[model samples]
Target: MKLSFLVLAGAQLGGVLGLWPQPRSLQTGSSVLKLAPTFDIHVNVAHAPSDLEDAVSRTKGFLRNDKLGRLIVGRGASDSAAIQHARSLNTLQLSLVHGSVVKSITDEARLPLGTRSEEYTLYVPADGSSATITANSTLGLLRGLTTFEQLWYEYGGQVYTVEAPISITDSPAYPYRGLMLDTSRNFFPVSDIKRTLDAMSWVKMSEFHWHVTDSQSFPLRGARP
Candidate 1:
């Protein structure tokens, strides 16, 4: 027998500010930012910047609209490492030249978040020349990227546009934000679980509680057994 269940999640973006769970702080600007059919992404690499590189790569992969253009990655300033190792670091900078197809993104510092740190600050300059997303850890970067992606809307059913010129600084109010899923009672397939995870990521959810064993059945197989 095949059983299907629907899960409903709600998110809200209000006038340059997101209403879903609400960020710590948000400021809206006057101008609207838009992306061209194609654009360039430049990643500044200095030392072993694997984490930042991976962040950019994953972000690019998420945005598979084909509207993205050339990807240029190079070595940044020598002091880049020093900046990344700072303690009180929580800032991101994003710059986009209006009428230009080039966008520059930089993370200020990658501070260590003990256990859970969803804290991030995003800035979209009113001048429209740039924007930034700052966070303490790579996890914060992931959250910021998810929020940034939500800013873009599809046009004519093909193109993606970001109505920007806004600033947002967000951090989770609660450290433990997650959802619980019961597989024993209903037996959800792997694909279904993945789909749920995708949705959770979009909303900056950090946990997935799987209740696999119950009175109904123990579908989970043990590798040792």
Candidate 2:
């Protein structure tokens, strides 16, 4: 809102508020304000509430604070519906990449039936100065929160600041995108599946193909063989 400069630690500091500069865009004085009719925001991967927060925060840094907004969080197919439901309440706009939508904000913590621990994409509104979030698993939620912190930390607190009409175009390249494991070939952990799913989402894969039939019976417990 205001701009001033002071010399401390042999470096000149200014009271300018702006998005942290990145390779993608210019860094103007932090005090710049954005005027917009629509906003289009994108978050590649979000599986926890914290990730939603960070994405919202980064988005705010780039645009002028709006009274209403939309948020889209995309996750792997295995993500629980409960996580996505939790994300809907606070967002000015809410949508899941491939996640389900919940009917009410009051029930944001409901996960999908028979989903695994790390499979979820939660979104929350960035309308208020801050949002309130609750997850079925406290630890899982914490991990999501940490993700937002990391995005800010890694980018030195520069948020995604821009003033553009809200429009987004996203679609998967394949009909079925998924995580595949050969249990008979080798035993892979859940984390590996999470990682693979994340990669698939980036490439717009919406289906999962599990080739569990091998010479030996590794017998993966989650999927029916």
Reference-based lDDT, each prediction: 0.52, 0.32
Distance from true location, Cα of 73 in model 1, Å: 41
Candidate 2 matches the true fold with a TM-score of 0.31
lDDT of 2 by residue, 205-224 (tens): 33456776666674656867
TM-score per model over all chains? 0.63, 0.31
Query: What lDDT is reached at residue 187 by model 2?
Result: 69
**Which 10-residue window in model 2 sums to the lowest lDDT?**
149-158
Task: Please give the clash total of every predicted structure, in order.
Answer: 14, 29
Maximum-TM-score candidate: 1
Backbone clash tally for model 1?
14
lDDT of 2: 0.32
